[model samples]
Target: MEKERKVFGISWNVFLLGLVSFLNDMSSEMIAPIVPAYLTEVLKVGKLAGGSIMGLIESASSLFKVVFGYFSDRFRKRKVFVFTGYALSTVAKGALAFTQGWLDFLALRLLDRTGKGIRTAPRDALIAESSNGKTGKSFGFHRMMDTLGAVAGPLIAVLLLGLLSYLPKEVLYRRIFLISAVPGIISLIIIALFVKDRGGEVKKKIAGVSSLRSRSLQLFLAVVALGTLGRYSYAFTLWKAEELGYTVLQGSAFYALFNLIYALSAYPIGVYSDRVSKKALIGAGFLLSALASICFAFAQSLPLLVVAFILYGLHMAVMDTVPRAYMAELAGEGEKGTVIGAYHTVVGVFAFPASLIAGYLWNTYSLTYSFLFASAMAFLAFILLQFD
Candidate 1:
């Protein structure tokens, strides 16, 4: 048998998958950082409604993760779902240029998220399969690539906004949305041409169903749920930037800074997690998140907000990259997709309530109250991790 090729100490599939994510994320992040502003400023939606819309958009795809994951395992296919999901998202993003109202935007956003739901689990399972016992390194590299695109995305948007300064703000935003689809299309092409299907064997019974009985997994899930509840939409961060008297372009730059730190830190942290305790690292991440929230709550200067965003980026580097590797480690032979799907589902289900709560606090009390709530919840999650 021919030896499988490796790139950057990972399989070809993993490398190509990372490339796909990089491009796709470039497309997504272009919109992500600006969506809240778009909703409130362009669509004339209120803060609470904007939060609810953002929350629903974030969780919409998560609702499909487990179902599609199980189907991927049962059907013994990955590429098809991955391709279909990317296609759907590309089309939806392109269609954003035509949205006339909040409802139209919501519909397109949900479709884009649905695409994410369909692909995430199966794509992750493929990465886990290709890890070669280096799950941490593989996932880290992938996240690094993905986040690098995130860094590039808002920067691109900033550049576009600057160059298109002559156009109306609404026209400029819509044009950027249309342009975002190009990267998504390129990502799909890469997937079609380079990514190979490497599905696992079919099992007589689903291992995902049995995984629920595991006390450790259950505890981990609870920790994730709590952490997610504290994790508000990134839109709130952008709003914070605006509240500090920054322009939309400046806010996008801050968003890019956050992603740049996340991109730079993810691979090193992921590699370190392999040598040390993932639980310890996760606990630290929660602590950092709490600190970030506290900083955001009290930030009165640009320098302090910068510190908060840096801490937030570090939290993302740990929470986003490590947990996927940990879940893959916990998964049985053929049930990686299902188990990862469950993790995503938990995060997704809780995200709605979490964002709603944050929005409510923001609308009813104050922005400080919202940040304090996140701080409390994250601190609580950190405490819970000790029991695990």
Candidate 2:
């Protein structure tokens, strides 16, 4: 792969996108942990309802990413969708402070996710376009910044909540959520100032679906979807840790450590990817995820859990960023948004079922079974991607 030269080996756009994600994540994380508490403790909803609401939000986010992605490509406009997505999420941050019930919160959550859905594909394509030859490093840098924000978000929430302890607990929670608006606004400013508006150029409008259905893209997406089917959310890892005699404090610390490991690894991995083969790195990522999942399944000691989580971070660092870089490489010029959108759409469509299967296996048999199944599927993806 040829490394596209950029100012400082990465364009200003990469920095801007990374910064935008950092701020957005920090804002989102500040409020995410409190949502369940507000729903159950304040609104009197059951646990099942809260979980279902989150599921809905995830699905909507994924679906909208596809929808907005198609439009982004169809119209050849990226910045406007990106701008709108951030704006909605920014508005949602403020709304979270004022929600009266679970349903209200659900609406805000969906709206927030809708913003995410709109921005993801086009933003990714924009990043890829800016860093033509060095997708790995650029995307890696972006992920690193984003993960750093994820790590910081929870800490900010804690600090803010602590500072507002004089207020009633419920009021304090709302206050904490309200503070998220600051970062949201800042990110929007950054977006307005730094993000370029790459409106579409005139070209023969091919069917977006047909463009996305090239034999190679189809095969790649199939492999990716199969791998994603095995891949469920990270909450199970925390559950596994708690089950293994770890306290909530330990589990929380472990998650922060995992994010730290993920952030630290991404840029270096991207640099290495450019020097070597992205496919091999992607395959290695799945295998690493398999290894990490197995570690989660059998963690008995703190040391083992640490290793598992670190490897888990590594798996994501590789799997998450490298594949996008590869996708950018694989997508045709005008079809980047559509092809990427289709890829995520497949994963979103299958995610609920994947989670359901994982939950069922964990509930019915053993958590080990779920992890093993995921490992096998990821390994299979790695193998299949090689042929691609």
Candidate 3:
């Protein structure tokens, strides 16, 4: 009898890509835990400004995804954009160390997210194409690596903070920012050395524009957009932890917990989706996210918030791995890059407003309102998926 392929295994390309992401997220998470604190405490930026900066960064990245993904597809190139993108991010992170004020920070974040937007679609397309039928596994493995970095990033941040407790606050943050650049450099090197261009698989129709005319693709993008519309920035979670009386370190711990669960579940859910319908998994993820958001809105204490965050992590795991896999399954060969980019761009466009709206709600209404708004959007998205 023929031996079955290893279910938990990934291709060399996927593994290497995962390693790159892992390193990158390590750098990202290192900053992520400190960002809200840095802005509010050190930079003296207000919540509205912080939220706006976050929204703009997300939106800018999505916009770049649209342009870069299309360009890569049309030109049949991926590595150059991918490499350039990572290089931009590395530079952005280094610049963050010397940021003078809110404007400088905003510019740094914009450039950083631009890199993210540029790289995401093409990178995902590469992973999808390489994995063949194991789409869920591929994305899951990648996410797992990414989350591992996420877990480590914050731990290192907290450790550094503790180690440098004797230093002035500004000096402490500058040191951490400087150190975060290490992973970025490492990731750039890995991508350059590995991750060759696997060009021109095939072209397929996309759904967004009426002239383009891929009904299913269009429908999927629309559904994803609507779902993402309620998807607010996760910084709110960290912010809420602070509002609810958690210390900076405590809040970071919660963020770490969230990533831990998210990392652990990513692969299992991916594997499970391979056996079951990805549609069901995606729908479930939306609903669970809604539930988590609601719990977060009502959470009175850190423990309850931890519960909410854990559910949120599970939601992230499902959404991260399954949706793209579903998209790949939906798209025919050769067009995966364009289709994926278009889908993310659409989602990214919505995410920009979603985060902005959440910011507005948080400032004008309440954090509860912001989360409830997200929950409602998630429900609408889930309902629309019924037609799928």
Candidate of highest TM-score: 1
Candidate 1, residue 142: the lDDT equals 93
| Model 1, C-alpha of 167: deviation from truth (Å) | 0.6
1 versus 3: better lDDT goes to: 1
Write down the lDDT of every candidate, Cα atoms only. Answer: 0.89, 0.77, 0.83
Q: Which residue window of length 10 is worst by lDDT in model 1?
A: 200-209
Model 1 alpha-carbon miss at residue 222, Å: 1.3
In model 2, the runs with Cα more than 4 Å from the true position are: 1-7, 32-53, 99-102, 161-172, 199-211, 242-250, 362-369
Specify the highest-lDDT model's number: 1
Alpha carbon deviation, residue 346, candidate 2 (Å): 1.8
TM-score of each: 0.97, 0.87, 0.93
lDDT of model 3 at position 198? 60
lDDT of 3 by residue, 17-52 (tens): 898999999998888888888888899987777787
Q: What is the per-residue lDDT of model 1 for residues 219-256, given as tens digits with 9 covering 90 to 100? A: 99999899888899898888888888998989999999
Model 2 scores a C-alpha lDDT of 0.77
